[model samples]
Target chain A: MVGFEVDAVLGDPAIRIVVCCGSGGVGKTTTAAALALRAAEQHGRRTVVLTIDPARRLAQSLGLTELDNTPRQVKDAPLYAMQLDMKRTFDEVVLTHTAPERAKEIFANPFYQAMSSTFAGTQEYMAMEKLGQLRAADEWDLIVVDTPPSRSALDFLDAPARLGRFLDGKMLRLLSGTARAGGRSMFNLVTASFGAFSKAVQKILGAQLLTDLSGFVSALDSMFGGFRERAEHTYRVLQDPQTAFVLVAAPEPDAVREAAYFASRLEEGRMPLAGLVLNRVHTSAVPELDAESSAAAAARLGEEGDTARVLRVHELLMRQVVRETEVAAHFTDRFPLVPVARVPAQPTDVHDIAGLRAIGDAF
Target chain B: MSWPARLHVVTGKGGVGKTTVAAALALALAAGGNRVLLVEVEGRQGLAQLFDLEPLPYAERRLGDIDDDLRLLAVDPEEALLEYLDLFYKMGRAGRVLRKLGAIDFATTIAPGLRDILLTGKVKEATTRTDEAGRRLYHAVVLDAPPTGRIGRFLNVTAEAARLAKLGPIKSQSEGVAALLRSPMTSVHLVTLLEEMPVQETTDALAELTALHIPVGKIIVNAARPPLLSSRVTQAELKRGLAEAGLPTDRRTVTGLQSEAHAHLARQELEQQLRAELAHLKRPTVELPLLSDGVDLPGLQHLAALLRPR
Candidate 1:
């Protein structure tokens, strides 16, 4: 298999944005940070990494004890790192697009508070929103985005549309009393089912939640149009020719399966997929010594000696290498054309600039 | 003897095999001819994948031909919400109408914690359910919950909802779920690998669960690798042993093998360090070995046997 040209993607001036996406705990954040650091340090490009990892692993890797919503420079390098503050980003969007008083009212609404902080898709949406903000700023020559650790890697792609549908959903408008004033036929349908519908909703969510939701919807009604439009605009930016998508995964069954799914989803969405970063892949030092032969040799000699133990260790390594290869082949065989850059499993966790640089060197 | 708890909530960092652990635990509980329910709430269809079945519906289905005692349920929040309405308010027709109008999506998705509330609500229902003969419907229920990063918030969402609802069935239901989650009958087990990041996340999750007053179960260490070589094996000894084994004694092969052995030793040392860290938490810990062949039905059974109560 041809190796993925990591440096080529990072150095390509035409590709302004690179999005690293995969399932949770697949080293997506590490890949993004490493790519950004390499672009800034090796390729001599100004780079910024926007990470949505709630654990803040990127901050520790960048040697910053803390990362705020805004980008901070890492050491003397041209690279900048920031963790997405989903709630604050949502609030900023509201505050920027709405009047101060209305923004305050929306913030005060319990539904708005919940939606801003704990909503299912809010992190993905805010990550996109922050990406749009960073790209519009145009301070960095390159932007590397680490998507949210969603259950499905495709959630980042689906979030904008989901949020748009929810904000423009007829049920929300009806609950907020906007549909009653918009169309006569719609108003008739609303009136016909409004009593029963609201009764069910109220009964399930209770009257307080319904009231708060209605208040939240009405307060943010004016900004809804902007929200959807911006979401659409950022989504378009993602689809632009200048953007590149890198699918990161470990040499595990689930992660590789997700990467395959995400690659196909990107193809369906007309997004440019650069390649796959197969992280934490196990490799055998002596590939010539097969697991079967090693195990047989170990058994021929008794298990008591150091030579037998060494043979056993070699056997274990060979087996792990075979399993990882088979697991990775599951993806590569399906998408044979997808370039792969396999990073050998590290002996310890990456927690500093040197460790990230080593990863970059591997890439 | 019975298991330690009737409801086992298995959570871990993503890719740490929580779903697999939960399934194994369910199978272990069912080994004694006890009826067990394994539930998945992430909508990831992980149980379906683990069991090699089609995507599971909101209904409970038998796992396989091995036994009739074990069943699986992939709880969908939307379905749970509609079911809740039908059960509590008898709003069957209204629920369908709401579904068409997108109110169901709004109620389940837009509300911050309502989706989680609905999910845990259903789990609580299964935990406390009784049959016509006044016998427990399930002897045990194992929940494959969200990862540790969100486990605290996911389990405690009912408290937040209770504060928000303030009235009606939602409020009472939230309070009921909260009580069930905090009760002694429930135990939240955290699964982790012997790696820095996962162990760190496990420790943090333990603190959060403790602070939330949720019952903490055993710390389950998954994918633990056994030490293959003695730590005292020296580089010179390894080289001599390779020559004695009739393997290549060339410098290149010797260098490669030595480097590999060094990495293996370093990883083993790190694992030992993490084991100590987890031991300091003072929770009963269980270790599951790494399955080199990847997880399958037989492998799951192997794991289940290890999980069986002694």
Candidate 2:
């Protein structure tokens, strides 16, 4: 297995986009920020980091009061940052792709509002949308995008198709027809065509709201292909050689499986995986003190003494290193082709610019 | 935890041990002769993998034994949707018709409010069910729910009810689910580890769940590293021992000792911060020590013992 050289990956002139992906709580946002900072400061590449949820860590590091859709320049660093606002991104898409009246209709529609914000795959879709926008703008030399640590790594990959299917579904066609028909079509014509299906929907949503939903759909009809095409474009950008997917995972069994799952999923999609970032790896300073030796030494010191207590702590530390190494070995053994970079757990979480820079230096 | 709520929704940041906590909680409840049903709503089949049992399908299957008192179910979204349709709408033969029309996929995957409703709806159904003799079919139902990021929306389906399915059985069902979620009968427990992100997410989840009127229960801090040092051993003493260990201390060996001491101090420092952050969440918190070799079937049983009431 090749050992991952973070410097080489960050400094590569051919690489422009780095995507940090993994299951949740893997320090993905931090990894993305660190890589972006490294690429900008060390590699001298102008960088912009795209994150779904930065919380306070990114804000503090970037020296921003808050993040919005527009990429804000990070203070005293050669990097830019923004948190994805899914609804705003969706609204921008609708406003840009459709007429003023239709945009108003969509923005006002409750169903549209719900879908744009809380729908299962909307954030994933908007993340891709925003990525496409950032790349198309060509404003930054390196764009680091952080995807949602979804329940499945495939959720973001599958969103475009699911969205296309929903938009192009027969229900939308029926709803749009009824809404557009505006009571002009014969009642029997509607009954004969939609009968049970419309009946089920009408029973739940009532006539007025269903009409509103269908109106929203028909208004969005002109932009359906545009959205799908953009998804394809983003999908292509991800597949490009200039792009690298780094899977960040903790030194835990579940996190290891998650990383492996993501690796294979990326492979299936033909997306280029740069390597695996094994975060929070427990490494020993005293690797020479074998566990057996440490335990024996502690036993000799007696259990109650201060020195014995130190050995006790030493044994715990030894056990942690042993476990973390096995977790790393599990990854290397499974996907030996993927290079692994280990980041030893820090004394504190990364909350500021220097912390992110330290992470950059760690790998 | 005596007579823990009938429906326990275990959720946390992605890496937190939600599945382990759910399985352990089920075992803990079942130890008292309660017929507990553990459901994996994320569909990871984590239960089957954790217990080393056969993979659970959409239907409930006996998972080895939590003393014959626990059953496992991986709530497949599609199957759950279909069953909901059959039970509520009595769609019967029309289910085939609906699937042929791609309605099922649209509902489960494409529809925003509908998707969460379907997932939460299944848990509600399982928890509220009864047998022919009028006794509860399952004494407790534990759901390894969606992570903290999505739990609020998953439980708060009322928005969808009010907007999409405004005035029908679906709306009422959504309201009923929300009510069940808010009631004392249900507990939305946030699971986390002694780490920043997980603790941060747990705190955030607690606020969100409380804001949504969902009963926020215990904060489970999982995978904590047990302190191996005696209380009296100071950091300096540990470093001193590392410096003077009974051996020919070479440069590499000294560096190793230094690294161990630094890691130990860092860990202890971080743990203090994480514990303080968790305490600020204002919920009763239970800490589960990090198990060696990573949590397995036996480890899960031991974890269950931890969750058990004294």
Q: Write the per-residue lDDT of candidate 2 for residues B46-102, one digit (tens) a residue.
A: 887788777788888776654557888888777877787688678777766767666
Using Cα atoms, each model's DockQ against the true complex is 0.69, 0.50
Q: Estimate each model's TM-score.
A: 0.98, 0.93
Task: State the lDDT of candidate 2 residue by residue for A114-204, as single tens digits.
Answer: 7887777788889989988988988778899998767876676787667866776665655566434545554345444356766766765
**Model 1, B1-310: lDDT tens per residue?**
2358889999999989999899889988989788999999988898888878999989988876686489999999989988988897888987887788877897777776888888999999999999999999999999999999999999996667864687877778888999988999999999999998889999999999999999999999999988876665666776787777777777777777777777888999999999999999999899999987889988988999999977
Give the proportion of true interface contacts each model preserves, from 0 to 1: 0.68, 0.54
C-alpha lDDT score of every prediction, in listed order = 0.87, 0.79
Q: Can you list the residue pairs that collide in candidate 2?
A: A285-B256, A285-B259, A285-B260, A286-B256, A286-B257
Docking class of 2: medium
How do the residues A181-251 of candidate 1 rate in per-residue lDDT, one tens digit apiece? 78768878657677887777676667777788789889878877898999999989988989999999999
Backbone clashes per model, in order?
0, 5
Q: How close is candidate 1 to the true structure, as a TM-score?
A: 0.98
